[model samples]
Target: MRLATGGIMHETHTFSAEPTAIETFDVARGAELWRYAGTNHSVGGVVDACRARRIGLLPTFFATAVSTAAADRATFEAMAGELVAGIAAALPVDGIVLTLHGAMVAEGFPDAEAEVVRRVREVAGPDLPIAVTLDLHANIGQAMVEASTVVVGYDTYPHLDAAERAREAVDLLVATVEGRIRPTMALVKPPLLPVPQAMFTALPPFKTLFERAHALEAAEEALVITIAGGFPYADVPMAGMSVLAVTDADIQRAERIARELADLAWAHRAEMVIRNVPPGEAVAAAIRHPERPVVLVDVGDNIGGGTPGDGTVLLAELLAQGAQDATIFIADAEAVRAAVAAGVGGTVETAVGGKTDDLHGPPVPVRGRVRLLGDGRFVHEGPENAGVPADMGPTAVVRVEGVNLVLTSRKLMPGDLQQLKTVGIDPLRQQILVVKAAVRWRGGYGPITRHAIDVDTPGLGSVDLNRFRFEQLRRPIYPLDAESTW
Candidate 1:
């Protein structure tokens, strides 16, 4: 049996000022992406599962056009066209598997995934079994449910199990292709829920929510159950918590299970909302901590959440407070270039950040000693980015007094400890670790951090969801309205 596989993964945060262009995507199709795509240990877990079942493997056509923020309409459409065409050309296939980030929004299209699914369905025909795996932060829409036979979202927020979810989708597709089962999708969109920081599955309420959801999946008819804790930053009509169930054509049962999961998420809405501490307070608390390693999360500047990753507020605060033995990462290409020109030992004075948008904060002028310089190439060793090789683009380690700062030409999310270590910064030994990331950093750094605190600084990735002027979101949402009931 012939099979087709491909992907269009991007989590667009609408508030971000930067527009994702076509060049921003790291597209890998045919054999190149597949060689290292499913070979990583994390991906191996999924590949092994499929191998054990003796399922024939097909070449994957993956085009990952991921920007931290909203993409330009033209760029989004063109990329979608490429992905659809790539899969279509390899068609006359039995089944299809896709890996997608559910929160993507293009310029004109509100439901990007729906459009992709529609295009793929038009080419592959209605009888073909299509299964998709999505990020847990996916703002799953109704059209996504209607276009595909089965949909499964990652259970964890940091998304350590992406490949595993892909395997699950493949398994379901194999079952459908072999005529063993008929998979169908059902969706339930509840009222707005809290952001990622508040909905940690490791904690209470949400932990119980997944537990009960899993218990339901153990029942005879249920194949898979997913609760998408919607990406709140995305200002789309489909923004909110959603429950999806994949069953053996038991539409009624799937609908009932989905509603039950939605109810559970809505019931604990208050507990799931997260509040952030100011930058000054966060740094002060870190200074007071007795533990050697304290991870300070600048949630507002998180690149993973579509922020510009150039916020100088946190760095300015750290410098102002004269924090010693601290490390901070700033995504400023100009600063790195200037430092490189000045040489490793020479000191240079320059204004860094405050370039993306005026709303966050102004740039801070600092005199720093250029320490180490590198080409900025490294393979990501984190659970979230197991096999993906990343580039920091002309990186330099600059020491502003005692605080060591990591400056890069490209926007880099510190997903792994090696991201710091590669530049000669050891987070474990340092007293304070400053990361420009949201909740995803916790997967790698949580174990080493003596204390983890989410700080409210100013940037494009602001957690103040109310600050964003949303024009398309559905009305009467929670938090946006204090007294609204679902």
Candidate 2:
């Protein structure tokens, strides 16, 4: 059997002022796409599954970029055209597999992933079996459900289950190609927009919800169940929580299960909202505790959720409190240039963060000694991107007082311990670690930290959905309306 694979993946934060240019995207095709073979990513899982099934894989074009604002129109066109053309070239395939981020919004394309499926379906005809996998934060839509043969989403929030979910999709694709199961998917979106802060699968509310979904899967009532918390940053009509149920040729059962899961999520809507502590109070509490390390999460500047990594709100509080044995990362190209010029063990004075926009706090002036300079390249030793090489682009470590400020040219979330260990900072020795992220960081740092706190900081990635003005989002959503019903 032969299966063609590849698609475009991106999470668009429409609220971000930063524009996503064509140069920002990473494109790979043909043999180059084989680099994902051993990584804990979507493509990696597809490669392994094909090998195990002895299926001839036709690798095609795949493009992705870090979460950012709406993608450029020309870039979006080029990517979509390339992916569709690849599918056209690799004809006579038994099935297809696509990896997509369902929340992607580009110029002129509100439902980007659905557009990809539509273009492919137009060329491959309606009878082709297509299987797709999406992130847990996908903004599920009816158009997406109707276009693909079957859809599967990551069940875990930190998204450690990327390969696992992709393998499941491949299994379903093989089953359909063998004429075993015909998938009919149903989608249900509740009138709620719960932030990513309260959507950790390991904790309460979400844990129970995912457990219920798993039970349904074990009972064979549903082949796959997805509970997406939804990305609220994109101000679109479909920007909210969604439940998708896929069953074998049973549309009614799929719809009933989806509705049941959606109502259950709506019932616990109040418990899903998380409160935050101010930066000063968070620092004070960390200092008072006897634990060796405490993780202070900066919700507003979450790099994974599409915010600039130069937020200085928490940095200012740490400096003001004269905090000791603390470390934080900032994406500042200017700081890195200055530190590199000063060389190791030399002192450099420069304004370190908040240069991209006025949404995050203003730049805080800091004078620190350059402790180390690195090439800013390391493989993720954590669950998020295990075995994948990350490039921060010209990195340096500056120690201002007792705090070690890691400045990089690229905006990267703190997802792996190797990001710090590559620059000589031991994660186990730090008294306080300020991570500019929400749930994603917990995959790596959660196991080592004694406690983690989310601070109510100010930036584009605010947990409070009311902080930003929405011009296009549909009304009557949770917290925004409070009395909204499904």
lDDT of each: 0.78, 0.89
Provide the lDDT at 96 for model 1: 76
> Best by lDDT, which number?
2
Model 1 regions lying over 4 Å from their true place: 39-56
* Count of backbone collisions within predicted model 1: 2
TM-score of 2: 0.99
Q: How well is each residue in 1-486 modelled by candidate 2, as lDDT tens digits?
A: 999999888889998877887777777898777888878888888888898888999999988788899887888898888999999899879999998889999888888888889899888899999999999999988889878999989999899988889999999999998999999898998888888888899997889899999999999999999899889899888888999999999999999999999989988999887789988899998877798788999999999899999999988988988888899999999989999999999999999899999988999999999999998999998698688788888999999998999999998878789998998999889988999898999998988989888999888878888887888887888978877766
Q: Compose the digit string of candidate 1's lDDT tens values, residues 112-167.
A: 87788878888888888888888888889988987888888887767777777777
TM-score of 1: 0.96
